[model samples]
Target: MDTSTSKVYHVDGYDSRQYLEHYFSDKPDLTFKDDTLIFPIENLTKIFKKGHIKGDLMIDLSTGSMIHYLLPSCEFFKRILVLKVKDRCILELKRWLDTRTGAFNWGHAAKLHVDIAGNSDQLQDTEEKLKSAVEHVVKCNLAKENMTDPIVLPPADCIISAWLLDNVCKNQDDYIRYLRKMSKLLKPGGHLILIGCLEISYYTVGKDKLHAFSYDEDFARKALGEVGFVIDDCKVKKRKAQSDLADYKAIIFIAAHKVK
Candidate 1:
């Protein structure tokens, strides 16, 4: 009788929400007091203004969940092309961008393009939410898809990848390849701005695990140099995380130029 013991199981919804929130929400450190995520936009605006990114066309790779929310604040770009690594983000971003009541003013706006490449296994549900929000969207993969190859891209004044390279790229070669591909997307003497987390560990979304690479100012300069991009001025800003459990507490922003 002693050998046969009953086992009790308990479930805590708070813990479950905490775990789920970790993946679904933005990094704790990246959030602001106003409840508005403005770091990416602020960083992009800083670089664009500093680098003089005014041009006829602008391309944004991996437009994150909040890009369209901040686009209106940036008045330099005449036309914006958003290339999302995952289809869901593209759909969500497009919906937000097209919404008249949304953060971005879509009424008096320039052309907006959305390219959906590769499906994200981690954020599938979120992707679905995004897909339902948009009508005109392109589906393709950034690595294998040839439809929108940046190499043969039409002349553009500038190209921007907001916190994208470090996530998709695995190693140095991958980074270089991405840079080269992006270089072909820009016109001569164009600029490229990369904003990423430095020394970050793995993050999870739902049940999926997303790995973060260690990228800093030096890494940006070196990688951009190999791809024929000149290091103009890299501004490193210290970003901190509010959660004590988080491994990474800070991040840096890198701004560089592509030379002819």
Candidate 2:
């Protein structure tokens, strides 16, 4: 009953399958029927389909074992580099990529993606495209100076961080640090897309609760500006208490350009 208390869990041994099942689903309540739960992703998917992001390579920081959001980007970028904080997360992603027997099912999210694009027929083709675009699913630590060191990656045309920064950082300062780190991963003038929680203190993964930074739109815009990025687009959808997944007030989606 005490939701206020939360303990951070390392990505190494976390139950990724369980986490995936709880969040992404075909169930309308948690999926297509609810805009708050699905809008952030829907909005991103639409943008990618429209070719908002450019370049041959796209890099995603802290993919968190979910490929639903990346489906759209797969079409535009020939190569994608997805990084996860824990090796376990990277492994979780690979299981799906490998099409293992027990891999997490993303039918619901995929369906939603096509639904938003108004092209239900391309479901299977779109799924295959996503699988093909992802060239690397590797380990990463945003706190480090070199986010993906030991494996120097080429500068990206665009970068995306979805709910990873909010979950990893303990405070506003940490958020700024990671934002700067993420910005550096992109080429100058490259765009940065972020999907994050707004004013949320904690989120649950299975039975365990985890810490999250509670930040608003003002804080987000300022943080991006202070770190030398220009905002191109930002979308904020109010959060609905449909589930106890997290106590967030809203979800903020931002597309910004890194300063040269």
Worst 10 residues of 1 by lDDT: 5-14
Question: Residues 51-82, candidate 2, lDDT per residue (tens digit)?
Answer: 65778989988536878778767767889988
**Residue-by-residue lDDT tens digits, candidate 1, 37-83:** 34444455455555366766766664344443224223565566656
User: On a 0 to 1 TM-score scale, where does candidate 1 land against the true structure?
Assistant: 0.66
Clashing pairs in 2: none
Question: All candidates: CA RMSD in angstroms?
Answer: 11.8, 2.2
TM-scores, in order shown?
0.66, 0.92
Clashes of each: 1, 0
Query: Which runs of model 2 end up more than 4 angstroms from their true locations?
Result: 1-5, 9-13, 31-37
The CA lDDT of each predicted structure is 0.50, 0.77
